[model samples]
Target: MPPETARLPLAHALALGALHGPAELVPVSSSAHVELIPRLLGWPSAALPADVRKAFAVALHAGTLAGLLVLVPLPSPGFAVVATAPAAAAGLLLEDPIERRLGGVRATAAGLVAGSALLVAADARGATGRGAAEAGPADALWLGAAQALALWPGLSRLGLTVAAARLRGFDRGAAFALGRQAGLPVVAGATGLKAWRLARRGVDPGLRAPFAAGAGAALAATLAAAPLRRVTSVWPPAAERVALAAVALAGLRRSPR
Candidate 1:
């Protein structure tokens, strides 16, 4: 998804938000969905500035973070604080440079494939009582590091975290629970940081309508997630994400925006 050529209107903004809410919950990369939704829907090819795209993504994430709070039991507050460290550090210190270098459509598509592979591998492992029940400081550190991969566009934060947990012996539900808990802080931190930066620079009045529309769509999708995700096992992500990445990469032959 090269910078969108056309202004993202309220309807399109809501479309992107609807995609983000559930994709973030599943193994699919929410960022990848955002990157593709515009193009996939036949938006114009004009180069959308990166900052606008970034701002929209940040706002969408905030809406979903709010949704997570309602549907899941968070890890203890102390655990949430310490566990969020590595990804938070990576986002604050490394995300900009990474986005500069690897935020391209091709690069992001590759991330989608890479992340999808991880999900498929985790699925292949099947459910086993071999799952571990212990949560310790070491677990927090390890999971946090794994989640740092999410700073890269098209890398699914939920996908990587759940994959890490599943590999470490957490059952599917447990992995999902832990991943959600670990994710909240990172999402909150990044959203807050981006909001601060936007405020400091002063937001463009043009951006407000789309941002509000996107956030509202996300909130609605998130509220419906409980029933939606119950039937959304790991299989669809394992398969659908690869197809999505392939489609995205195929359409990405245009010169860099």
Candidate 2:
């Protein structure tokens, strides 16, 4: 089948979308899950064109962003702009190249392991007391840099941002808050940009229903998982990333390619 014509079954779309919510809310890479899950399941969507997959991923992100907007308080405009600028610039300049070169399972597995290690180190060394409100220009810049680094597949935006915040000495609650707030603008901007491109190109008629189903599922799942925002430790998610990376590596080994 032509990659563009490959269908994403509604069941697959809904499953991925539902998984997207909590995966996005936590430190695990939601993009990794979206990509790897389909592959692992031997779903036809795994063979879709990269552009089509990306568009669907953007749709999921849009839903997640909508939920985040409701759950997370609006950040200060200055903080939002500064904290999001690095990633915005990076995405514009390097997103395609990075995706082309580093979007493979091997690279993603390496990124997962590396990012998990960083999270562990940061959490261990970080001291408690500072709140998200205490973030300054330097904090924004550092957080923005972390977000930029996350453009590499499996280097999760949420994980990196939280690690950056923790390294900056924020408490668990504060780090989580800072991570979520710092990420909101970036996600919104990326989703909007991609959605615009998808709109201009026009979605395939066959994809529209799946797209809508996925987006709705993501939005509902995110809202339902709002309570997970209170999670204090990053260790569990870090461990999960490592385990997932192992699974991906094992799968890669088993593949004839």
Candidate 3:
């Protein structure tokens, strides 16, 4: 922070954390919210550097990982290992290129629309019999493959993971648990990589404040989003599409020639 600002903006960090944690826990295109919400509030542009923004996102995710661990019980160690393999592999291969080239507002909007459709369809058509304990490596792989969709950004990792699990006949709780569990390894890996990159770029001392705020907010929100028993319908996420469209339109107007 500049000397003129004096105190660190804990409120902004908390607001971002509150926003990121729930959006992430519910898996509704948190990638969209992390960027869109900040840009919308002007929290991430001039006031915060790009690197700090990335750090804050990573920290918020780390916090969500903690909440998920507590809120959703993990599968067996072997079960989780095998299940996380596909997405971990995918992340190692594709993370950089996607971040470098595919991350843009339009791509995000398209992905959110497509992902929302998948979430609702999976919920509506799924048979909801098996529970999370019944989920095996094969099921993990299925959800892991779905997790790859998050590489595109604006596609909810939670959405695709839950959708795939639900479609695989897992019950709602099981689907949600497995979906979130499956994401842990991948998210952890991605966050670690981001932190490493930030370190190489010479980590800023200011990163700590945002990290603390985001982590705290994410921890609270993740716990809250769980056990809420959301009944999925088509219309709710439609509003998300509208929001994304508006964001895109705004981005177009703001883009420089």
The CA lDDT of each predicted structure is 0.75, 0.90, 0.71
Task: Give the residue spans of candidate 3 off by over 4 A.
Answer: 1-8, 44-49, 199-201, 224-226, 229-238, 254-257
Residues 80-125 of candidate 1 have per-residue lDDT tens digits of 7777888888877887699789977778888888888887688568
TM-score of each: 0.90, 0.97, 0.83
Better of 2 and 3 by lDDT: 2
Give the per-residue lDDT of model 3 (tens digit) for 2-52. Answer: 532323367777776777766765656776777766555555332455445
Per-residue lDDT value at 131 in model 2? 88
TM-score of structure candidate 3 = 0.83
lDDT assessment of candidate 1: 0.75
What are the per-residue Cα lDDT tens digits for candidate 2 across 113-144? 89999988999998889988899999999999
Q: Pick the candidate with the highest lDDT.
A: 2
lDDT of 3: 0.71
- Candidate 1 ranges beyond 4 A from true positions: 1-6, 44-46, 130-133, 254-257
